[model samples]
Target: MKNNPHHPYHPIIYVRGFAATQSEIEAAVADPYMGFNIGSTKTRLAWTGQVKRFHFESPLVRLMGEHGYRDVFVDGNDLVAGDFADQPIPYQSIIVYRYYDEASNDFGSGETPPIEHFARGLNKLILRLQDKVCANKRNNVSPEDFRVHLVAHSMGGLVCRAFLQNKGLGTEKARAAVDKLFTYATPHNGIDMRIVRNVPGWLSFGDANNFNRERMANYLDLPKGDDVSIVKHFPPERVFNLIGTNSRDYSVLRGASSWAAGDASDGLVRIENATTHGPGADGRDVTSPRAFVHRSHSGHYGIVNSEEGYQNLTRFLFGKLRIDGILDIDNITFPAELDKYHEENRAVRASYQIESAVSVRKYPWQITRREIRENSAIFRTYDQLFPGQPGTKRPPDRSMSPHLFSVFLDPEKSCKASKSVSLLCDLKLLTPDYEVDGVLFLKRHYEGGVIYQRQILVEAIPDTNAAGGWRIKYGDQENNPGKATLVAESRPLGDGDPASGLVFSIPIQQKSRPGLHGALRVEVRPWS
Candidate 1:
């Protein structure tokens, strides 16, 4: 709405993540598309060791085919030169930051600049893009349509944040030019290892200060003692984060890095730190939309190169219809005979593993998480909602929890091209009970933490006329075999039905399991 009525398919600026070593930095700078052009052949061999062979081609190529966008690299030059040189740069184009060029053999004197300098360079890059793409000419798009989406990885995310947040790091015009920002495995809150995740006070040499919370705060101009999650300059909603949960695969530093970072990490940045601040500096409780992928930071199973990452990236930038699915938790039926323990502070703690696969003929799934691994498709319900708090003056609108995840349904990507958006998903419910006698009792795989998995179908009919224009439908796929949906009702906006809005209930009919027999809702909205 700010610019054209299009799905905000403005230019994209690729920002690659941190290069730990000089060799790594050089490798990062050497690529014209930074790592966007890179492709992976072996994308997670299936259970049978039979490789699924998901050739993504590359995000760069897909953008061209799926969305009419071109990369601004010709022959060997990073950009066009000399008065357009008989050929003008296209309006909807993609450009890599080439930020580490100074340190690469092909460009500068092999000296890497600090993050602040890289950030300032980003501002300059945006302005340059404005001049090239937005200026009036034959195929010119107006300055109003000049906004660019920032697709960044790792420390590159911080660079974008710095440009927007750190005072004087970038001009207001440059900042406004950034319409949407998407990051894959970006350490938004700052990196941590083992328990010593925050950068040490003494290790101030080299680029180590880059991830240091204090240093990052100083460079990003964050208020003293505040975490980097809090954002003030930019709208939190415009940002999207793709989190990598597979740690065993992130073999950087020969597994030392992964081991140190430990559980619930992409093997470097913990899941907690992988997203932007849930609440901004102003205490606004503004959280960015993010999706968890079963990928590493980088490599074959990396968040950048894999199908899941690319699917998320393309849909977010180009997808016309958006749907969000959530569970309307009415009741959590804890295992009976265990209620006596509830008299004390001890109670059953449950975590829900939500794994969804977009059912499309052309592509297997934009994203897929079948089972619950440590950092995988599992979205935990850590908040304790006990049976005791029922009639005790409950908070307003307390029935719904945060959305499980947002599924961007692209018309072009869909085979049906927007008849109805559907997601075939399975939710694994795990109850890791509290320590009975002082011995902690929650070991994974070997059997202690994990519990249940439920399969369901979530659907919504698109209507541009209604607010959010989504007539949602959901049901238990496994339980209700014949019916397309158990709940065939439409969630139309402005109706008095609690399910009318973006958030609609999914009645969990797993009565036999004696597990949490409650209904969940779907919260669908436009992300772009």
Candidate 2:
């Protein structure tokens, strides 16, 4: 009578991050939820040195409260360990893969097992969960319909990837059961320190070598010289990478970890290495959907325990619409003085930075943010953008265009019960200083100068009866605040199915010299 295996509200398996030391592992084993239940009560104001009491009831509690998801533990015993072969649990359950229990002295030999071992355990756990879930008589869920979403943090993401990618580590049935994956501050490219570059493969203390790229390659079944972020076995689009950009709040090891990890990190995982990319349907590498939040790696302000992280997680898991932004450049114009220098063939070079902050209409926090101040803005060199111009013979690479952000939106969460969803994108194209004849050309240069900056407000009205099933309108927020007046023409992608959604192009051009000429391509698609 009940929808047991809901379409989007699938069972969530929480895979906790790495525990560095023996004590840490013991502590991890002691916790029932493995840090997933941990919440925060205070937040620091970024602009002002003030602390605010913002109670975040953690992702675990929030899921149980907002959604009807229940934990597997019943009567002080996990359902997996109990005699529940015939007993059926709710389809929307939260299962914690307690892999660290094998390493804890209280449970096993007090010796940590390899990641492959954890991955194999996950496979077995999924099969067991499938058996139990399918046993429900009232629920109409078949073995093929039984799916689970993996919500992991830090190194746990790698474990999920291993279970999906490494054929020997998991069964095909278990791999197929995995519907979607959401990772928080995961170092898909392996952890790298400021001084050490990459974590040494020989550093086996507390299994630190697990973060090493070579070690990861072996366990993840990645070929030599391959990017560790590439996922070959699974659909990368279904994976959402939540990247943390605040490093100052990560006080792990008395701030030593943040120091070693350096800037542009979430105290532990570097921003550039946190997300992942994989081969697209056309055999080209495509980056997974990802967002940036100002949260630490793990602490009171950790990514997993924050509101921003939970919002993104819930939307990605149950959202109705997915929107992606990409900046496609047509051409860039230089000042007359710089053009004259280029005409002389004296070697002119300039690099640009693109900054963006994305947020929902009523949400206070930005879903994704990249700025020059945070050192997370998209950067491209003059040669990379305008190749074959002055110094090189190769043409401009359109593939080099920067992806701004990919955000999932739930139509149910539309502001004030409105039928449309409003997304605000504050974008900035910063100007680059020039170099003539390998010398600094600072004749009229100024620091922190932006060539083009505007806040673009996009309002998407989804109508089933519409031509493309959606009506999109956008406006420059700088000129017309809090409004989207310009109707966006629907350009359907791929087969032009309404489910595939449509693409809207917003022209971005600066008529003045030393400016940018580009189009902000917004792709809207139906997401489950």
Candidate 3:
């Protein structure tokens, strides 16, 4: 370890591919069944050396160090084969287990083994790792205990799901053992990579005795009448999948049908296949809540190395960020009285052009900015009526068209004025009727994307409903208080603009209870 006692334990264990025995590994490696079959042993060996170099050496080790984690031990995938005894274990450790054992032809399918088996084996090892740590505590090496956070890639997530779903661990035991589980491109529902000639047809192979697919089904022990479908039994809560894709083509499985069709694949797995879903998902659709990204269809294998893939992965793993909505801009803060660009791109007829431009661009600003024309209105709308003033009530049909505010990100802000800030809008947010419309620009002061609603968290001082302003009641306010005051505030200034851009226009909601003068203050901390 790096000698940092305060470092949060985030030991990452990387499980390599098929671990079928010596002859099997050799046969798979030599055989030309698929595009490139390295078998279990070699792949595990390769991953071992690779992990030591790329992950355990310079870049990855340095990155984790920056994140306040010590350099934990990294074991090869075959540590179960008496490898651990040969390798000297380090301080904090990460034990990677092989999904398929070479000595066992159990992993029937060419893909990774079924999750339940993987989980059973993994959990056994985890229990051992825990015991080892606990032993150290008793030996006077550590003062406190810590939990292990997992970071699995590809099918490893299935293993995590199996581990979590093993109710035998009990809710508390499961939660205590695994604090956070991160998977990169794991296909929770057996990804439909389109690699098979037809999905239903491939699923039919479940009946063919001696067929690889049949073996796989038997190994998993799906309801195949006395066969084993281990994964069918895992729990769902303790896993997080990191979906990745690239615009390149690394997976070239000849003879087999193209899995992605014309769409993108991360080489081996399709973007959709890399997702996770189960009972824990509740009722959300594949695209609801808008979390994962669909990048290039580079094939399944190399998606992790792509720029977009890496960015999304790291963001999901470390940064508590979310793209709530696109920022539509109604007013551009061009210098006062400065001549606005009146190019064909800026005219009212250019709406289609603007929309098209935003769709293809990742960075919102790539959409050219247009000069504002004198007396030119962006668009017109029927003035919608609101619930007229409380006391001076008007007819129910009263309506007014209010200017939409556009938000922006101003990286150059020196804390002088808000106008100098810019905004961050995604191309998807440019869609007119989306609920998150006008949310493109983010408030620079908060360091996170804006949302449409917020929950407030504060302790009320001199708690009085009549008071116009809220007084800060700091520490210990949860009980009795003589605490110092600390003010915490936030608000969901809905999309400020109608046109998409970095700087978004915010819409002001109806005022708080007619007589209440103070603004509604909201506060939130994003889930990272």
Clash totals for all candidate models: 11, 0, 72
Q: Give the Cα error of residue 465 in candidate 2, in Å.
A: 4.6
Per-residue lDDT value at 406 in model 1: 63
Give me the overall lDDT of model 3.
0.34
Q: Write the per-residue lDDT of candidate 1 for residues 1-528, one digit (tens) a residue.
A: 254533377878888888767788777766667788887877446679886755767888878887789877676555632345445677778888888888776678777788889999999989888887655375446665668889999898999999988867999888887888888888888888776758775665548768888877888788656477766688886788898888899888799989998878888988888878544545667667778877888887788887788888877777766666555555555445333443454643544554444443345554644245555554544353333452243332453353566667765444375577677665666554434335444443334343446666776666676445665666666777423455444454334453335656666665643355556566666555
RMSD of each: 4.3, 2.5, 15.8
CA lDDT of each prediction against the hidden true structure: 0.69, 0.87, 0.34
Looking at model 3, which ten-residue stretch has the lowest summed lDDT? 352-361
Candidate 2 regions exceeding 4 Å error are: 1-5, 43-52, 85-87, 391-396, 415-418, 496-498
Candidate no. 2 TM-score: 0.95
- Could you say which candidate leads in TM-score? 2
lDDT of 2 at 436: 85
Once model 2 is optimally superposed onto the true structure by TM-score, how far is the C-alpha of residue 235 displaced, in angstroms? 0.4
Q: 314-405, model 2: which lDDT tens digit per residue?
A: 99999999889888887777789988888777788888988999989776788889987777899998788767756335455788888998
Ranking by TM-score: 2, 1, 3
Q: Could you tell me the TM-score of candidate 3?
A: 0.46
Model 2's C-alpha root-mean-square deviation from the true structure amounts to 2.5
Candidate closer to the true structure by TM-score (higher is better), 1 or 2 = 2
Q: 1-528 in candidate 3: lDDT tens per residue?
A: 233352344344555322224444444333322111111111222434563222212224433454543333344233323435444334345444544542334444554334455667776666655555545533223313345666665545545655665554224343355545656555444434344421332443312122232333433334443222123233322344444333244444461323443244344445444443343234322221212333322233343333333333333344322222322222211111111322221211111111111111123122111111111112322112213332243332312221111111212221243212112212211111111122322222232212222211123222234122222322222333323244433223324221111111223232321111112222111222
